[model samples]
Target: MPGYSPPVSMLPSALQTRVDAVEDPVVKQLIKDIVAFYDTETPEANAQDIIKDAEVYRGLGMILPERRRADIAIKQDRLVVIVKDKVIAQGDWEMYDLVACLPVPDRPKPTWNVVIANSTGKDPASSIVLTLTDVAADKFIENAKPVSIRQALLDSLRPYVKEVYDEPVLHVTVHQGSREGVLSFLHRYIIFGYRKPLTILPLSQISNLSYTVVTRLTFNIVVVLTSGEKHEFSMISHDSYEAINQWVTDRYLEDLSLAEERRAKKQRAGPSELEAAAEEASQLPEAEDDSDEEEAEFSEESDSESGGEEEEESDNAGSEAEESDS
Candidate 1:
């Protein structure tokens, strides 16, 4: 072996601070183990081995589910996952739905974060939906506090923030449970991802969404909405990107056209103040008649004054000639 240097056990100083902050022994241990594993070269460990060794824990079976390490990262300065540099699991940390907070050129912080857990152990074809609500920081001190996404950030940060799709995801988890239910859910999951592009216009424009396997099955869907909402849908479904893209594209265009038509209708019906005023004026009696009457009176007075001046001038000229002859 060429100079096998055991991977240096190191972490960013800030991450070390986060590790120290966690109070739960099991969670702290898992974080430490994951960190250590990431520091090493054993990237081929199976999920079973990783779970049994207390290297990682699942959220559902635990008594304190909040403390359990689920498919995603929660309660840290930042969310990150460390996989053996080799195991290409679908739920690997980097394979997450996150968008950069700022412009790409600036390398801004990540505003939204996501993590997927492969629950193949519990059910060969099942998954869990982890709905994270915004809780107050004060509640976190007592235990957990749930709140809306709107309340999480200050008003100033609202404009720049991006969020997950409004729809609740059909998390296609793989496990061993009711075979009928499992198959049904999988069918729905496949159908939904397949039909989505057809219903969505932006998705139709997408060339494809790719999926591959090294350790775990992963579907990487790059969806673009007609409204320009770009998202990466990563799951364990076996559907190809082309199918997903087409379905999403059709659906998005339909929605976009409907929205545009509604906007145009509202614009035509809702009149402005200026337009309303003009319409009201048109409905009233004629004011131009008053203006015409005033002009007629003024013209008659001018004609009478001119006639009086002409008579006075003739009388003055006759009087002057008689006085000169006398």
Candidate 2:
């Protein structure tokens, strides 16, 4: 029987014409092999498995990127890939969501938007010190409506804190009426994987936060991370909200203590040239006044010499006059 014919609609016109025009049997066989390959399927292919296979291809000089980037680690047995400080695996997350209902009497419900800002310094160059900001909608917070912003936040401070400034250090401005919006903004910076010390304080408690000297009302508490990176997290706190705020702040501070120590060491290691120059100047000897003394001594020597010459001349003249009279 003649070879089976493909309908015009079933085959692309160009491909159909090319196949019909093929004069050699060998060329037709090559086209048949390509079609068969295209129709074949691999059973249940996983993307992770395919990526792992491609990496091995690169090892054998198959393909390489123009510029090298970070490599993802692979788990052959589990068919998974691991990136720096992150891992991907197939598993159910529902089981991981189980929670034990241990009673936390002091834990307050999260009421305000978590504010994360940079608090490095007032200077333009320093990186932000992450801080949480809490704004009051009503006098719902306990403890006297935050007499001052610093007072509201300062009392909640932990020992791991490096410095507290009553100014906003963030390069960008963020505001939200709801708590979720504020938290979503903060979530972007939380990937540092370092447990940063958290400070939750009210903006109303601090007086200096809005002053011209400070320029911002956000209270900043420094958190030294174990990774040598400094971050700032701030939020408004009320008396009723203090419990949960305290929990997060304390945990962050405890985890960042090692980073705090490292930061302290780095800051103390070397002094600026200006500071060194000032110290050297303080140790220098005081200047002396020698010009007046030198002038007085030279004047006295000249007068004494002139007086002696005059006396010698007078004595010689008297001797000569006496000899002539005799």
Candidate 3:
């Protein structure tokens, strides 16, 4: 939940004030001179577009934030990531387990470049030097944003991933072209495949499994599904078939036992639970009747007090009138 600190705004405050005071529109020559001086002094200085970059930079977000940094589109229900200029809508993961991490690769926190500018001019300032440095972009998530779009973006990012397996209890092998993929075994189910299209398989769907010793150092595992479909995974060098088989069998039995235990608990709580709930509901009317009697008694006492107050006020008024007449 904690995040990085905010970046310094605009140029270093001293430099920014000087830039703002330059009301004259025709200072391109002055900017160039300042830049030339910085060029000799610090080659990284860029003198161009000082006015545009400094002033209007904040307004770019006046439009939708998605329109600017379109990396991850924050819609109401889905998450869209633009990878290599190709827009991909990831439907499988709506909310993340941890906001920063995905199932495989993690999401990068967004950052923006801060323009570091100073007067690089001599003889009453002729030019400026400007360079950029990256810092965590807190603007989108800052409290002062008008549309609360910042909150919406943060809300979409947090605390809802169906996370399992601290590390992938075991890893088989896959054909993902240099990207490491593994067959993750968890207590509940098997994350059968990995990366491209990770699939979760329960005990009901798995038909059978077998291990093959391709060689002394090489091995293979094939899992058959109820639909008669088979998927094969090759193990890394020297990984024994016995270890993989044992792990799979143990995980499967653990999941099966947990499922059966839950079912038995639910069955045991069946009829008596429903009858107890109904009996509790039936007592509500009797409780309401007692409350109603108490309210009636309270109203009668208030009415009697009101009547006494009215008589006392009348007597006081009559005495005051007699005093006025005398």
Each candidate's lDDT (Cα)? Answer: 0.35, 0.32, 0.41
Off by over 4 Å in 3: 1-70, 73-76, 83-87, 90-158, 162-166, 174-181, 189-204, 240-243, 257-326
- Report how far off residue 229 is in candidate 3 (Å): 1.0
* Alpha-carbon lDDT of model 2: 0.32
lDDT string for model 2 (1-326, tens) is: 01111132224788878887898989877776564333222222433333443211111100011112222212222111122222222111111111111111122642211122223212111111112224331232234354432234333321222233332222222222221112111211221110222222322111111101212444333344333444443432232134434433444454454346557888988888998999999999999999999999999999999999999999999999999999
Task: For candidate 3, write residues 52-141 as lDDT tens digits.
Answer: 221111221211112233244333333333323333212223222212111232225432111111111011111111111223234433
Better of 1 and 2 by TM-score: 1
Instruction: Report the lDDT tens digits of candidate 1 across residue range 155-232.
Output: 212232232233222333222221211111111122122110211122223333333332344454443433455544
lDDT of 3: 0.41
Best by TM-score: 3
Candidate 1: count of backbone clashes, pairs at least 3 residues apart or interchain: 38
What ranking of all candidate models by TM-score puts the best one first? 3, 1, 2
Error of 1 at 297 (Å): 2.1
C-alpha lDDT of residue 45 in model 1: 58
What C-alpha lDDT, on a 0 to 100 scale, does residue 316 get in candidate 2? Answer: 100
lDDT, candidate 2, residue 22?
Answer: 92
